[model samples]
Target: MGISRRATAHWEGDLKTGKGQLSTPQSGLLDNTRYAFSSRFGDEKGTNPEELIAAAHAGCFTMALSAKLTEAGFPPEALDTEAQVDLSMEGGPQLSQITLKVKAKVPGIEAEKFRAIADDAKQNCPVSKALSAVPVALEAELL
Candidate 1:
């Protein structure tokens, strides 16, 4: 079975001054949510595509790590993952780098084993796979 998800983005006007709205009708997390150039590039506080990608990557990787750990007989007590997306604007807008930092709490798991599993999750997570064109770095810590 193939599962599909959808999100819609609506924009009006030009790139620099245009206003956009994004909605995830299935989840209802965003309903005509606002996005503007200022939000994306300036100091305005609002959700942008990069920020959303970071959130998605972090959530996906953490869940993937938990599943992999469970499969390895070392289920994690807790996992915290942070994904950072760097967008380069020199030639044009491009995703330059993505870094994933994960701290995991698991009992009886050696550092080498945990690192290997975490790297596996980072490489195999859906979001990571989707963004394979971009460079991704993973730093995993076992606590």
Candidate 2:
């Protein structure tokens, strides 16, 4: 069976100055959280889709890296991943690329081996798979 998660959004008014709210019933992590055109396109302070996508990608990649390390018997002591989603508007608004920066501390694992696992996780994580159309670049460090 496939696991399913859900979030909902409500928007009012036109695209440029419209206001929106996003919510996830199960987690309530985004309970009526605000989003707006300025927030998405300008420097206004509010959540945007790309930011949310970056967060999800970071989380998914981190977990995937942990799984790979555990499977290889490395079992990382700690892993931190940050994903940056770049939006472009040359033709139209679209996600152009995603960059993942990962830092890991895994006892007794060689740097080369850890790099290979990190690359694999970046390529095969669920969020990476879902966003496969967009380019993904990874910078991994073993600490």
Lowest lDDT 10-mer window, candidate 1? Answer: 38-47
lDDT of 2 at 81: 86
User: For candidate 1, what is the lDDT?
Assistant: 0.93
Task: For residue 2, give model 1's deviation from the true position in Å.
Answer: 1.0
Q: How close is candidate 1 to the true structure, as a TM-score?
A: 0.96
- lDDT, candidate 2, 77-114, per-residue tens: 99988899999998999999999999888999999999
Model 2 lDDT, residue 62, Cα: 98
RMSD of each: 0.9, 0.6
Off by over 4 Å in 2: none
